[model samples]
Target chain A: MCLGIPGKIQSIRDDAGLVMGVIDFGGVQRDVCLQYVADEVQVGDYVIVHVGFAITRVDEDEARRTFEVLKEMSQLDELEWMAEAAEQGMRGLEKPA
Target chain B: MKYLSEYRDADIAKRLIGRIKTRATRCWTLMEVCGGQTHTIVRQGLDELLEGSVEMIHGPGCPVCVTPLEQIDKALLIAAKPNVIFTSFGDMLRVPGSDCDLQQVRARGGSVKVVYSPLDALALAQKHPDKEVVFFAVGFETTAPANAMAVFRARQLGVQNFSVLVSHVTVPPAITAILEAPDNRVQGFLAAGHVCAVMGYTEYEPIAAKYKVPIIVTGFEPVDILEGISLAVNQLEERRHEVENQYVRSVRRSGTEPARALVQQVFELANRQWRGIGEIPMSGLRLRDEFAAYDAERKFGVGGLKVTEPAACRAGDVLTGRIKPPQCAAFGTLCTPERPLGAPMVSTEGACSAYYNLAKYRTADPAGAAP
Candidate 1:
């Protein structure tokens, strides 16, 4: 029951005094309770849904920091590749400037 | 999946294992205080990878495994009543009570259902106004928020027939009990990351300072577990004890305040009896006096039921890390997953079930090759 999936909110509604939303987890969509994140969540925001409840909103900066920590620990080699690719993309944009 | 799939990468796990090996000055014994962490460690063969570097002992973190037997009996008593629907998480269906479980109760024409959330049980009460809908609320701090919110909503909607049989526990108290034991050998702990996500790491700092053990909040993945182990090992090597967070992406230092407020509004502290371990003060959560009307025990009048565990089951030893699952005499012979002599063998997050299902630590070198 502790297992959670990060899903994007597709839609939200309040019916019979309950805040509910349809969250899309990968390709599957399920209804989730939004009482916990009702103040912060929007229709397009991502959330961590556990046991049919949206427990927390997803943060991009925190996600990036996690990858950076992994990189520092020599765990994520993909982060290095991603950084190199971003640098090349930026160079392409710089030549015109 | 963004934050999760990356942590489970095999290449990352390999690198973290190498780092863990280098950081280990000697064989250090560490206990992960969550059954979810135990399942991940065994299922991914992480323990096998860190064979000689460190020893990972399982702790009493499974809610179903540690739920007092009398609570199960009380749930059974309420479930078998006429015009009542007993709802619980799927894991609780097979957990044995005194003589029968909820699954058997369903087979005998009892109105039992499996719900993913307590809110669903409240919905059931709304649908069937004539029937009583009782939810088996069992978990740690990770689950109390939702359960509390359900009760709060039920009161708002005036859902008279919906109630909860609560068996909520906290992680910090369990850690203290384990450390205070006379035979305790745990040098450090990998605290449950999900619990920390709700209630924060502030409660763990005092425990770490008092017990003189590093408590690291960790997630349920290969890299997370290895990184937490490495952090704890670094502390043990430096002779320092403090609470650290390895699952920084999801968990904050103070946790989610709104969830904490909701839980505090609905529940209060109470002494509770664990299934194998007796009573620990301020370990369990009970519905507050204002929400007492929503308590299944008071509503259904099933409070006096009690049952004793079998003498053959040594779940207490396995829970406290005193012995491995294979060391128990009735482990495979009488306590298989199909017919568990104890709750540990039945719970999906339990250490014994993880070992038995994966066929781990069954070789000539028992105890998962721990020296």
Candidate 2:
């Protein structure tokens, strides 16, 4: 039941009786239930989302720094780079001219 | 550092994907033996980023998906009891039994509550001392400790009204069953890291060696899944089948001793039936004879109830890795999240649910073609 993912808060929308927030992880964006932590969080913050609910917030600077280390650790081989380039090419083609 | 965000970095994920593509020798079939990993892989599109040479298959790690129809029927029986407050994780509410689901029971005026923790059910029992509170405990070893703890807590607190309808299963036995299956397609396994975090990796070493397949204990993150796949692919390419620990940060060779001790004290291994896979010996946990007072099925006389599964549901084949959700006759047609034909299509951690929510679009794609 643990469906937690680290996502950066893109924006928050306040509506009647509910708060909606858009969170982005990599390129996948999801509308997270911010009702749980609406009072404390802000745009540009990072949080752990579980089952569409934002369970807790994570430090944005610390999260970015950790990603940096993971990025370095991932560079342990070259086939990874080739796959990334190919994926990037696909993404480039998908973009509107 | 949260230590969680670092594990999910897309840049790091890309790096791992790059390494996997470079190191591939032949087409390797790696099965992530947990439905949590399946959801993560699909939701993040990690499989789309992997090298075409590596194929990631979903395993039967979903406890709800693998839970037999008889058990769900038993749960419904307990829920139907007057003044009985049947509490379960939200995922179990929609899982269809022989005839109906807990949701249907709720509609019929049964007191069915969805709790985030078993402790909450314990609290409900404390609050309503006059009524009986039965918690439908489900999941693999990952959830066994907590469920066992709830039982122990009830006993300690002298909450006579509280009992657990224990449906806890183990991972190793299921893995062994799958490997022994005649139509087994899994070449290697990404063992559920959370399960190993509780039960440890000691039991898996023998299975890996005996089956001659690599078992990597992996976390539920895109990068973790990629790393697990990379490790498994490397082992398969080199013909070295061994138990590897990619989730070393949380799981140890010897798991939490205190948790295991509590579980052992409360529950005993029993040959239980899986939804689609029939009976596998010593695959499930039941209340020990000593703890029979805390067993809801025995206390309520719901043990002997016989129930039949839906005729068209192919959840058993899907659970054993013999077929994917799309292969099921009812999948995407008669069965869906709203009207699941089986438990797999209903549970959040189910492979069918994972496919339904994340990969149903692929049904229209060319078969065996990469996105």
Candidate 3:
């Protein structure tokens, strides 16, 4: 399975020298192995957990930037659609003849 | 749902689709090398929406679907033993082996358990020191690190009862296999984002160069996939072949170093056999010689069992994108999620299962994979 779900790390602790933590995935919580991302991730940080391991700590700023850019692109396209629709409306007023 | 729900934005997905349509002068056949992305494309009808612009070929990225029958038989053999407690991810339970599936063994009083992680199987070994716990470790690079850690931990703490039946396959080699095929029509690829998150995109640069194909490391969400398709289409339009990263937030160029390092420590490259596609040299991973004691095949003596694939199932064609699941004569009638003739139907992420589960694409959908 290649699917990795993003979740927030609620708490962290060492289990026999491995960095283990409880990851809250929106609501449900699971004990995820944070040893791979131990250096960069701490409590309250978001990470992509796959098969009980935190593969990477999600970059919040970068994530917000990516989403905002998508929204902006959508907004720009909406503007384009409005312009085309208005132009069509203007053309229709030229009369059936 | 902060990071996830935002990526499913419908407006963004539609805009990206519009952009991809505008950029393509001719229909480009692109393959998404992860079955998760295939599921997203089929479930959302993303392929249908961008019909003429792009053709999405489902690649052999489902681990359950591609894991060779011999390995499944070994897993079955081990599970059937009275002293062995076989554990695997839930999805692998129904994958049909040569004789039968792991679920059948479980039905016949076998101690088979579905574990969320390899570590959970290791925990079972610790809990019951008398029984031998064998975890059927099968997946791609996204799962290698976790399975590696389980073996490392077992050896570190002297947990002798634990071992793993590793059938891990990497993505790049499989991609190469597809591009090298004589009838290949794929011009670009959407690399599995999670796989890149573990192994990074550096390995893909050389592939893009030599093959002259664009490889976009993409995520599993609708918007993420559409953006990946958009990037690949843009590159094709300009005749630019390179490795692009559409999933910037989670994946880094170097990937998670610790995970890669640990996986390197535990596993090594070996010739692997894919169920439908036959053998691809060095496409799979096996536990290193140092961990032979933890290798289930060595411990159980089930390493030499080989069986032929049933002729009724055209998994090879479906896996290689030569034909769509619905195109298969046995797809819905002879083979199904209920009584799967092959692994593709049993696996949730398999292309066949995706096509079967998504009824909207069943009626010769123009956007569905070509014959």
Candidate 4:
């Protein structure tokens, strides 16, 4: 299971002895069973849900840190690098044997 | 804690998108072979981010969408029995079978329940000892383990009232069928991560080599889909055809061994018919002879219930990626989700349902409505 999708917990309910909650992933909301990881969760906190179950809680600070790194990496233009590498290879081939 | 939150960070996703845009040289057509991935792609508007350079085609990964009309009819038949309590996933309730569905059966005073897991159905049988509980087990390899576990538990508990109407299908065979088709145009594949997690990526290696297509095991998320596409596009650009694992955090080369062994104990490969795709040899699963007592088809003696799909529904074309949802003549006018004329419009994982939910707004414009 891909423990993805950081959904904010809206509310909690006990349905037939099973801990359940309504989780919001942006605008879409779905009912998720929280019995699997109920001991580690709380309201207003974001948790990683997978296959209708909340698997683990995510630290917002950690998420923001990772996003910043990703943004920096995205700025690198691969096409320009590839073109430069190709031109260097062509010059080397022309000068040598 | 999981790799999930890091992978789905929007800032990172935009960065990945920018990286992909810079790397792209030519247009590429990639197909996410799992219906779950299709839903994830649409839900997050991943297509909008890719623009017109990347084409995402839907594949036949939806079990409910591809399950034959006749099998559903047979399930409806079993559910209508006076002492039977039919259990199924909620998505199967509205899938049209001949003239009726599980929802229709419930409306007609039949005992039918929507259960999240087959174990729940087994528990229902245990609690209601007087009634016969037959689970309408329908899914791909991802769901086979849980269903198989339920069967094993039923045998151990000697719960005679419990059984399963298994409609399980395998992934490799479907991929082979799609690649072999004369009209197939899938240049790359985003293999279902969960299916690979259960059955491993070994089966896909041969298919990828034979078809000369890149098969990347992908998770269902916005960034996961983009990363999968980027990987596939890289392979295509480099002319390297191989099976890659983008969801390596969960999937492995051998997959879940215990789960596979459990499935082997309860089920066997058999030639079965798909709704729109016709019959694919040895693609479906059937209960083993020893576990035949828990096979609802044998218990009920309802053979030869095979029925053809409706003439107006082009669900087969939709499943094969030969046509989009709007390409079907009956898509919007006659086959809304509330009044589905076919399985694709009904199941949540279905391509048609995804398009209906996300792309319907875009399709409102006359120029964009042409599929």
Best by DockQ: 3
Q: How well does each candidate superpose onto the true structure, as a TM-score?
A: 0.87, 0.77, 0.88, 0.78
Model 3 global lDDT (CA atoms, 0 to 1): 0.83
**Stretches of candidate 2 exceeding 4 Å from the true structure:** A2-97, B1-8, B359-371
Candidate 2 lDDT over A1-97, as tens digits, reads: 5334456888899634446677775555545556546666899988755434454556776445433443432311112222332242311011211
Q: What's the distance in Å from true for residue B2, model 4? A: 21
Interface RMSD of 4: 20.4
Q: Mind giving the per-residue lDDT tens digits that candidate 4 earns over B69-142? A: 87899999999999999987667888998878898899999988766456667777988899999998888886
Query: Which has the higher lDDT value, candidate number 1 or candidate number 4?
Result: 1
What ordering of candidates by lDDT runs from best to worst? 3, 1, 4, 2
lDDT of each prediction vs. the true structure? Answer: 0.80, 0.74, 0.83, 0.75
lDDT for each residue of candidate 1 in A15-97, tens digit (9 for 90 to 100):
67678887765444556788777898899888766566777777754434443443322233222222332343311011111
- Candidate 1 chain B weakest lDDT stretch, 10 residues: B1-10
**Model 1: how far residue B330 lies from native, Å:** 1.7
Model 4, residue B119: what's the lDDT?
A: 62
TM-scores of chain B, in order: 0.93, 0.92, 0.95, 0.93
Worst 10 residues of 4 chain B by lDDT: B1-10
